[model samples]
Target chain A: MSSLAAPLPATATTAASPASHEDRSSFAFLAIASLFFVISGIVALLVAGKLQMPTLLGNIAWLTYGRMRPLHVNGMLFGWLLAADMGLAFYLVPRLCGVKLWSEKLGMATMYLWVVIILGAVVEIPLGHNQGLEYAELPTWLDVLVVVAWLMFAANIFMTVANRKYEQMYVSLWYIMGAIIWTAFVYLVGNFATLFTTGVNQANLNWFYVHNAVGLIFTPLGLALGYYFIPKAAEAPLYSHRLSMIGFWSLAFVYVWTGAHHMLHGPISQWLQTVSILFSVMLMIPVWTLVYNFFATMKGQWHQLKDNVPIKFMMTGTIFYLLTCFQGPMHSLRSVNAIVSKTDWIVGHAHMAVLGAFSFFAVGGAYYAIPRMLKTRLHSQALANASFWLWLVGGLSFFVSLWIGGFLQGLQWNDPSIPFIDTVKFMKPFWSVRLIGGTFMFGGILLFFWNLLATWLHRSERPAETV
Target chain B: MIKKIDKNNILFVAAATGFFAIGGILTTFAPPLLDASWAKPAPGLQNYPELAKGGDAHADLVMKGRAIYVRDGCWYCHTQQTRTIEADTVRSGWRDVRSPVSTPDEFVFDKPHLFGTRRVGPDLSRAGGKYDKQWHATHFKDPRSLVPGSAMPPFPWIANNPAELDAMVAYIQSLGRAKDWRPTHDYEE
Candidate 1:
């Protein structure tokens, strides 16, 4: 499986090397970001396990399941996933655009601001200062900080793009650019910074913001990295540039409308719900295009899935992306939502998209990009392989268990004959399964982070010539 | 070396910015797009006509029930209104069939539609016709005893004595109300 390890053409590094100072600084930022994520992953495992036995945490105010659950989520999403994505973007965008970064100062400042904002979130969310929305758990003040940080990051990236030496913009550039721009717009509107003081429009705006945060922001970034890394690792070009373009536009068109799908079966207007459902169903076109393109690119290159760790991650991430999207549309169906709209089913669906799809791609991008950027061989391919399997299995387990549990709980709750207690009792078993699945996922995350740390810390003493 | 911004890129930026501008404008002028009627003011109590009617007595019970609801945080989980659908109606037992077919307006009386987002417990929109006072009392006292894995925290203080229990039951019964109707039979399993 490791047979694809041919040394790259020496010509790849012909361009002038930027000051080593900037490269080392970027590595330092990435290392800090990686450490934060690894810590968050550990905390998530602890929280998941503690929820199974609430008394284990001994009634500490900060450790309660209600508060800690959001902490775990925010920590992982923003602290880990967003930080890694930004770090990778900083590294990859310049390379892909055939130019040096627009401003290392801006990148460093953004990183520092991000750490401060995430610190505020880590403290506030668990301290019971949340706004009570699921994904929008951070209080108004921290949210503003995030927006500012994002603006700085966006400015840096856009400026870099503006100064690109590449004549033809690559597909990866489009995906990254779209992700950043759409996220800035969506974050502002969804958070309702303008109308928020009214209080009357909070719920509407909350769902709008929460859904798009995932659909527009994280999803696009993940797809961007996936598109870039998959082909790079496979030593192949993209299957079709036209298909990638169609996928990008269609996704942008469809994802915003689908936010109302979360409000299905609620007090939202029927027309709004109908619009959401329609857009959700229409999302299949973009999702399928990307899926088809990736799979088509692998038509004759199936052997790389086992041989290359990055390909393994990308392939599995893409597969989960397809499933998450398919499940998304199905769950949006009013008939299906009637049963599982508010249950752990949504949690399972979210994990599939966030953890299974996005996290996997992020890791794959890191694995592929980091070694190249550092000009060193990975410390252990075997560990990377193991991490891939663990993450893949753990993620699958979590998805399946929660999906079934959510369905069963929904069915039982709505059954007039079955007393609500019976439903709760029925779910005890599933809750136990969820805990186990969560443990597996946490373990897998630990393995991946461990491999990453080892690779970074134990690289060959002399850096290979720039490539 | 800064590359010149091209016409195509400028056009793209204008179009993208315009899309959001239009979205914001539409969101502003759009009629309250959400159906938050359940959370709206209902001048008087409303109940399902098909269920047993309780004229003035039922209205009093419902009023008493409202007090109990405020006291117990029943609003935390159970929503009081069902939307226009067979599944909703079937689950909550509150069908609004004024004409040959039911329309969305049937739930117009609902203020701030407590049609809640999560169901930590069952829907109490139609609780008045669904269960007897005894069942409500027992369940309130200890949900786990009845429904083995119930996440609904027990309201033992409300159930330790009979007077507190009656108030709780009264609130459950008052969820939906109507005049000129009598519950034909006592609520049963």
Candidate 2:
């Protein structure tokens, strides 16, 4: 069964292979980041479990719901998603271009800076040094770390692309390059614009920061990983290169304007809201285009998923991506927004995308990179399989429960006859389900980490024992 | 056709960033200039100017309480914006009459804007006068103490500090109150 170590892509056009010392160093970073992901995932789920029970630390300052909420979110966004994406890029970019990483030392530096900033946020946000923006909560002082880390990431990768031994850029290259540039712009502008603006003007900036963080940062990078992993795992050509281009450019054009939809029916102008809603609706085309393109590429290879762990993760990610995009545009409609805004409905949608869709991409992509970097098959196929099922079942449970709870909450909120606390009371049962689902999800993350550790240990070289 | 641009990633980066920049101007930069309502402040003097015309600004104690609210991250759970919708307006008359829909100007003085993203709890736009200091203190110390079904974490440890408790209640009391607020049209909680 362990003949599962797939051969390197036959299309090696690179002079410096992915297994070079430079790219291989990313195994350390990826391993560390995944460890952080599972750890923080457990903390986040623990907070969810305690929602109905007595507080975990009884409000010892940072353990309260307020502090834990941001810690959970930032932990997921930065510690898990962004950090892992960067790690994959470390392996993917070097291999795709057939060039040695521009600088492994610099990559390592970026990882450290990245972790420190996230750690600082994990501490600072809960301690009340927050910027008060959703998803962009790091105080400006801590935010500077992201800017520095991005520049380091950019300089290294842009230089690698420059020195590429290959002439043609693969699809992953375009996505990785674009994701890096756009995220820097979005994070910098989104975090800092509030300094110059006031009132809803600042709100315009805040929501822009919040939405684009997911759309620009997570979405493009996620697609990058999916593009690389799917063809490599399935041993098939992408359905249509032209279609991929269409999806890429259209996504770039459409995603930026969709942020203000979050501010709808609030104080934002009707025109702004209209533009957000319309652009969001327009997003459906590109959304379908990508989904169709991905599933088409999997034609005749669907059976590989049973034996291929990475493919399983990627396929699951794509399905959730489809669901997220569908729900996103539909909910942006004004009628839906009326009932859904400020309700648990938004939280449910967030889980569908953040935890369900894009995060699935990170998992699949990380698994793909780990074996390649370590020069071994995943240490335990059974553990990987277990992680997959647990994640799938837990994720689905989390989504269904929250969605029902949120929808009901919205209806009750809309109906003035039902007292508000009654709605809260009714949601308790659903919250209990969410807690159980969260536990399984957290358990799956732990199993994934354990598998990575086993893979690292399987390496005959004692990199672990020495260090 | 795609291969040419792939060779030169610099151009692709520029193109992508250019699109975002254009979007920024259209969506973020230009909208407020087009709509002046974003920063429009409420009418002068805080003691219900519509009724008597010489209301004072919100109390200093309330300002201190607002700081505590920010510190505790109450905005994470409780939203402050009540939309111009029928359900929100009617549900609020916590004290005497139906509450008024929230206005843009009610938030003009806010620096970071406390229009929260979620409502794990009820909207706090008109949380003032609905309960007194004792209620707020008790509620903060242990939310489930008041409502057994609350998702709120008990903060008795944090609330034990008198300054924290005092400031928090004061800030909550300041919600929905403005100098020129009309009793019938504005929040009276």
Candidate 3:
């Protein structure tokens, strides 16, 4: 494994890289984010298992299946995934823009604010003070806190990019910039902070926000990292800069309109529904463009899949991204959605996209960037490789099991003669499979956290770490 | 070598633009094709019978139910509308042989049909006729006791308050009402 150490570029100094200070802040955020993810994953696994064996958990009011499930989701997405991605954005955006972070203090402060907002959720949601919107379930006060944190983050990033050291901005910079700015706008609008008085427009805003959070924020960041890291890791340039531009522009234009697809067959206006559906189907163009660029870039570099840990994570993520987006549009079609809308299928699809696609790339980017930034070798490539395989196997298993389970649940529910409770009975076996999948995914997450912690701690221990 | 805009890229962009244009045009000209059956008005609502005129009680119940649905965020997962037969009606209860399929016209008078698509819980479209008020109340209070492995979270607080429980039940029972409709014999109790 020491052979990996020899491959480090001699000029790559620990502190000389313009991004070292930013890396420290990013790493701190990521460590906290990883802790949150591990905690959330453990909670999810416990809840999934408890659903089948409710008596085992001794019915604590807050720990009950009803509350814990949403808590797990909120924690994982906002606390873990988004936090980690933000760390990546902070580190990568500065480097890609050919400048130092506009304000390291601002980045640190944003992290603190995020922690506070999520901590607020930890207290509020279990206390039964939620607004009851999935993803937007945080109490209205916490919602304001989150918006403020995001605004701070946006201002810092935009200012950094505006003061770039380079004249030509990379495609990755464009994506990251778009994600930060668009998220701030969408979050404000969707929360209806100004327009809504008594939370009457909660549904309209919740759907608008939750859907865009996934489509706009996470999706763009993931693609941005993919566009940057894929070529960089392969020691090659992008396949087609023009295609990347097309993908970015198209995704930006289409993703906002596509959120309403989640409300397919809803009570929303027919015009809104039709527009959402049309845009959803049209989302295929941008998705395909992205898929094409990633695959084309990897054409001659397929060998990297065997040797590079990060590439393994990233390529698999791209594949899942394709599958998730493809499935997303299909499910948006009124026909497929009828059976799978609220089922474990959508859950599976979400995980496939968010966890499977975005989390994969996020972790890969972290791993790839960490050793270089720290100017030290990774603690173990084997652990990194193991984490990749475990996540790959586990994520795929989750997607398959849940998709099938959701479809079956939908079918049984639609059968008017079948009592609703009986449909629950029918789902018992699938629920078991889902638990199994959740366990596998959680196990993988543990390995990843261990690997990351070991590397970070190991670097700190080195008395005089060198490039 | 950096190349200028080539024919291939132009063709691709043009094709994409054309697709969007055609979609916009089709949507503008034939808007009804997009209507889902769940959002459609029911026969009873569209063609009110003389017998339906006196049921202010049911209307009040429905109005109360609407409040509960909104308050609880039930619409997050369960849509009230069903789309046309071609639009995955089977999964959404629109084409279920045993259930009454809604037509587009049925929703003409609906302020906003609650026919949601996501089924975090089952569709509540025909829920009025299917389950008893007590069953719904129990299920709302604690979903797991009724459905062993439901992701649908229990709304226990709603039931703990008698007024709220009554209002919610009244609302659920009033969900799929038509102006001329009568309760099914099974639901009369």
User: Candidate 3 docking: what grade?
Assistant: incorrect
Error of 3 at A213 (Å): 1.4
Instruction: Tell me the lDDT of model 2 at A134.
Output: 76
Better of 2 and 3 by DockQ: 2
Candidate 3's DockQ: 0.13
* lDDT, candidate 1, A1-467, per-residue tens: 01111222233334665433234335545565666777787777766565355345634545655566677778888888888888878877887777788888777778778878878887786566655455666777887898898898888878887788775666667667777877877777655452332222444555666787888889888888888888888988889977987887677667777666766765556777787798789989989999999998888999988779999999999999999999999988988887887677877898899989998898888888777666677767887888888777777777888889889888775655665556656666666777777777777776766766666665555355544
Give residue A103's lDDT in candidate 3 (0 to 100).
83
lDDT of 2 by residue, B1-189 (tens): 445665677777777777767886788778877888777777741422222223333355566666666666778888877776677766665534667667666676665677888888888887776777777778878888888778788888547989767767767766777533445432224
Counting clashing residue pairs in each candidate, in order, gives 23, 5, 25
- lDDT at position B55, candidate 1: 49
For model 3 chain A, where is the 10-residue window of minimal lDDT? A1-10
**Ranking of all candidate structures by their lDDT, best first:** 2, 3, 1
- Please write out the lDDT profile of model 2 over residues A319-370, one tens digit for every residue: 9999999889988898887788887778878988988888888888877778
List residue ranges in candidate 3 displaced over 4 A.
Answer: A1-21, A54-58, A193-205, A411-419, A461-466, B1-117, B125-171, B177-180, B183-189
DockQ of each model vs. true complex: 0.12, 0.56, 0.13
Give candidate 2's whole-model lDDT. 0.78
Q: For each prediction, how big is the interface RMSD? A: 6.2, 1.8, 7.9
